[model samples]
Target: MKNLMKVIDALLDGLKRVLVRFREAKLGLLFIINIFKIPDFISDKRVNIINKFRLIFALTIAIIYIVSGIDFIPEIIVGIFGFIDDMFVLVWSLGIVNEEIEKYKKIIKKNKDPKIIEDVDFHIRD
Candidate 1:
């Protein structure tokens, strides 16, 4: 009876981990989609070679996700391999999105009006 209980507990733990990984992957995909939709990110003036490469890479990964199917390792077994693949893709996509966001933020910050800065500085000193 004790061994059966232990087995049940292990299965539950595995299920929880898989669910968490799935959720993370979904969030990562959403982030990538949002990045692709950003007008500034896709604009001719703002879209550099790196941004283009990142976009292409993300699309390719998404295509793979669709073609390979979510159950790469056979969902019945609940193997860690498939989950690991998803987690890897999620991390890679997140990294790419983060890099692009940082680049965009820097550009926007640099291009901010000098008058805006002067006004803020004057107000802060007062």
Candidate 2:
């Protein structure tokens, strides 16, 4: 019973941490959701081929990690802990990929409109 409780507590803590990070990285989270729209988003002829490839690669890796069942922490060994590692990796990778996407967006926007001098702020702050 104690062990079960411990596992539950650990899972809750992990969840809290994930939520905190999600809050801090709202733009990244949003971009991850936007992954589904990649085909439409990248349809613009002005979008660089390289940027499109980067987004596709990152998303592919993320999908593979999820579907391959190759986990950093196996559920067989640790009850709830197993899933946390995968979530961490996915979120981390998405955040990175989102940064790249943001950069690409800025380039496209700037090219289309010469008056804009700075990158648009995507950060969501408390």
Candidate 3:
């Protein structure tokens, strides 16, 4: 078991080195980070609605591109490895939507269970 783990670690080290050598990996990493940052954009009250709409539009386009075979010729020629990107995009979008829904639920809960306190002392005596 120890030997197997050692081999796996060696393989990962080599893979990491190769991935760093490839410049596209950094761009892909950034894309992944941006995808996860969707909730931040949604939660930020300071951000413009138009900017948020644009972000959603871009994500929709990315999903369309992944689902359609026109953007990537590999899907046209190689049938077996094609569904990977489609599945990835689907899961990513679902994850973002789920997170936003949870955040909204939290906001609603806070509103429903109000514990208001005013600085001027909101006290009423009959």
lDDT for predicted candidate 3 compared with the true structure: 0.57
Better lDDT candidate (1, 2) = 2
Candidate 2 vs 3: which has more lDDT: 2
Q: How do the candidates rank by lDDT, highest first?
A: 2, 1, 3
Model 2 over residues 45-101: C-alpha lDDT tens digits? 667788778777767787888777788789889988888777776775576566565
Model 1 residue 33 distance off true place after TM-score fit, in angstroms: 12
> Which number leads on TM-score?
2
Model 1 lDDT tens row, 80-119? 5557656555555555555565566677777765465553
Error of 3 at 37 (Å): 20
lDDT of 2: 0.70
Q: Determine which window of 10 residues in candidate 2 has minimal summed lDDT.
A: 20-29
TM-score of each: 0.47, 0.55, 0.41
Residue clash pairs of candidate 1: none
Rank order by TM-score, top first? 2, 1, 3
lDDT of each: 0.62, 0.70, 0.57
Model 3 agreement with the true structure over 1-126: per-residue lDDT tens digits: 999999989967755554443333234444455456578667766555765675576568767877666643366666768665554454454444444434444555555433665456566899
Given candidate 2, what's the lDDT at residue 5? 100
How far residue 4's Cα lies from its native spot in candidate 2, in Å, is: 27
Give the Cα error of residue 101 in candidate 2, in Å: 2.7
